[model samples]
Target: MLNMFNTALTALNANSTAIDVTGHNLANLNTSGYKAGTVSFEELVTQDLSVDSSDINGNGIGAPVLSRQFTNGTVQVTGGLLDAAISGNGFFTVQGSDGNTYYTRAGNFKLDDSGNLVTATGENVQGWMATNGVASPGGVPTNISIPPGSANAPVPSTFFGMNMNLNALGTVDGTNGTFTAPVEVVDSLGTKHTLTATFTKTDTNAWKYDISIDGGDVDGGTAGTPSSLATGTLTFDTNGKLTAPAADAGSVEISLPAFANGAGEQTVNWQLYDSAGASQVTQYGEASAVNSNSGDGSTAAQLTQVVMGDGGKVMAKYSNGTQKLVAVVALASIQNPDSLVAVGNNNYSTTPASGPVSYGEAGTGTRGGITANALESSNVDMARELTNIIIYQRSYQANARVITAGDEISQEILSLKR
Candidate 1:
């Protein structure tokens, strides 16, 4: 009778614990990146009942053990630049304030005042910083920083291209027709200079062109006056296609003299051909007009915004209309994620049962791909939890009834003795 009472008590305790675990899951139904908690019950030691001691029956229910479900959560698009979600398996690695490494699935990150990316609890997000616009995934992970007022150095003009139409019906005499096209180029010191090209009809199928710069010196010429840089003749075939100065040899090399403002001399290659090795200048029977002009140079630019991209690449956009990779978010995968020790704040710490963490770049190996401007909703299913609540409630009541029945049987035996 006493053994029966003890068994019922143990069962009641286990059922109560199970109910509490279900309540916990219900509480975090809307929590971000929250994995549902499940309670598992195991049988306790059984006692031999027969005289031979070979046959045995269960003694009582054992304590319930709580573990995470580790199931994937629904991804919600939040449209926040730093918001991120894992589409498969992996956790975002962060360095906690306790100086211990922690992993989390919640990616609601923001830039701290010091420009380091951190979670709501202020843990530093780890990643690799890009150098020279290139990132190495195998590099060591460090705190990702996007300093305010960050600026990109100026890129001197190395190549310039223009598409234009040169009038084929212009008079052959140089005095009768001249066309001028101006292009903007940036020097090493980010100083803008206007390069003017003048074309004069010199023959029936040829035109002489002169490249010069204003308020500057060209090829070490005197400043404050137009200085000629290069002079060449462009010969077109009868079909109006450029035939002379073959595509490979159709580049103009010019040098700019040092400016008074301390800008260094800039050497630029003026490309006459486009990417397809075709002449940009056409000798068509139309009015002379510059259709488009482009150069590979820009003034110094300040950081405009930092955007998180798919595959965990953090890109910084500059005011000069350029984007560069700044960092790569790191991800960690464990053999048994459910065994990870939850240290609160939606973070998990490694345990012996969880196995070793496999660190890698997002979207690589068993890691999941990152989704920017989004977040993962909790995996908790409210309807399921509610049903579990009722089941556990019934279980608790049944165990309590068992204890009541055992007590009544003991009382009946006592009454007979009285």
Candidate 2:
């Protein structure tokens, strides 16, 4: 009888453990990025019973908490630049303001006071630093900012490449003759200058006059005569890469006026003057050009503004009206991601199990390139949790019933003895 009571007590304890495990799961059901725990039972081994090692195993006996169970949860989508989610097997590395490093799967981040990328709690985002094409891991990442008066310019080597399709039949009366546009150009010092081009119609199909850029121009022969820059015909191959210059090459090389400094991006005024008899104006927006049908084998983007592709790559315009690569963003990658330790707050740290960190771009390897204003969500499965809860409840009830029946039988035996 005493043995029976002990058996009942053990059953009660097991049931209680199941209840606690289920309760914990329910508590964290709504917790963000919480990996659900699994409660498993292991039967106690008894010397009297010769249990087969491979048959019953430990499934029939004791119940222990299995917190290490990893469930691929459902991810919730949130549109935010700071929100990030890992697609494969890695975690984000974070550094607290106190200089402590932590890791987690969560990727909610924001800009810190010093303009460094940081978490909501103000932890700094960790990654390798890049200068030019080379990169190295560092504690401080300089703020990414666009310099003021950046010299963003129009492209193509030969000036006045894309000439306006002049109306061969249209006539401009000298009384109201005008042609103007705001052209953005980089100066010898790499500064942005806005040049306002003015033109006057001189006669049919033929126009003449001075090209004043940013209010500056060279001697135009006689006071109002632009003999220095002679008028030229507009010729185009099927593909519009300009087959010819808009005006005749001058006796002296013409120096195209450009912006002043080279901090980064600049906006300029591009214009053409009609001094013949009529006035007209034109302007270019963010796009200098798109696709082009031209003699030059360059793509359409080369027809206007500088063209560029992904990463931190960009088409750079320099002083002296030149264009080149100004800057580019670098990406990094890793391996053995499963070994990464998860720190709270959606962060992860590389451990020995994870091996050495391998670097690559976002799209390279398992690290998918990032999308703006889009984030990966937590992987939590609600249906699975509900099912697990039901199983636990049944186990708890069975164990409680066993204990109650044992108590009744023990009472009957005690009464008989009395």
Candidate 3:
């Protein structure tokens, strides 16, 4: 009778624990990156009732074993600038406030006050930050920090290119003899200066070229006068193709002397041909026209926003419509991810059972690729959990009936003695 009671009690306890596991799963159905808990019943030790008869009887139900399901959940688009999600097997490396390293599947990250990438609970995200728009992710990763309001310094003009045709049929004495092309160039101090190129027809299929700037832009000169900086001659063939400036010859050089604005000396290269040896300056019979001209220079620009791009890249966008790859988020892959120990806040700590971690950039080795502007939802199934709840409830009720029957039988036996 005592054994019967013990068996029923064990069944009740196991059923109660299974019900608790189901409840926990249902409660966290909406939690981001939450893994569902699963329960499995185990049988206690059994003994042979009679050795000769070979009859084996089961003892009782033992406690249910609880395990976590590590299957990936559905990825949903969130449209957050910094939000990210893993598409396969991998975890984001992070450093918790406790000074311990952790991993997570959640990618809903934000920049803290100090511009450090961190989770909602303030855990620092680990990655390789770029220096001067270059990043090396092969090295050891540290906390990724991108200061807000950062700016990109201005770059002075070094190369100026133009694709235009000087008239081959124009005369040398009329107003058609001179053609001027004005382009804006930047000095070392990021000051804009207008440099003009004048072409004068000297003879048939021959022309004199002069590169000049404003006299006031120099150290000492008149404000309104145009100062010549360089002079050269352009000789074309009968086919209107440039011949004096040979194809093998390099770009025309323009040197700027000391400026009144205290800017240093600068040298700008005037390209007559493109990289593919295509002629940019031609003496065609068409009308003289400056079709296109450009200079490589920019003013200082402010940081506009930081965006999370695909493959775990962090891009810093500037107000000048330029983007720089500022950092790369690192990912970790474990052989046995199911063995990881959950430390709350959607993070998991490494354990001996988890095996060694393979850390690298996403889409490398066994690590998964990342999706920008998205989040991973919980893996809990509502219908499955609800059904589990009913199953455990029925089992618990059956165990209670056994206990009630045992109690009634004991009472009858006591009454027999009375």
Best by TM-score: 1
- Rank ordering of all candidates by TM-score, starting from the highest: 1, 3, 2
Q: Which candidate number maximizes lDDT?
A: 3
Backbone clash pairs for candidate 1 read none
lDDT of each: 0.86, 0.44, 0.88
lDDT tens digits by residue: candidate 3, 31-121: 7788898988988867665574456566688888777898889999999999998988899999998889999888999999888999878
**How many clashing pairs per prediction, in order?**
0, 80, 0
Cα lDDT tens digits for candidate 1, 1-418 = 7788888888889988988888888888888899888988898877665555766766798888888988889999999998999999999999988889899999999888888989878999998888978988774478888898888998889878889878988987644368999988888877677889999999887989998886543444556788777899988988788877778787888776776557788788878888788888889888888999987888889998888898888999999898889999999888988889889989999888888777789878888889999999999989889999899899889989998898899889999977
lDDT over C-alpha atoms for residue 365 of model 1:
89
User: What TM-score does each of the candidates earn?
Assistant: 0.90, 0.58, 0.84
**Runs with alpha carbons beyond 4 Å of true place in candidate 1:** 173-177, 216-224, 238-240
Error of 2 at 191 (Å): 6.1
TM-score, predicted candidate 3 vs. hidden true structure: 0.84
- Model 2 C-alpha lDDT per residue in residues 138-243, reported as the tens digit of each score: 3332322223334433332223322343333333674434555444433333233433434455554344434344323222223333322223333333333223
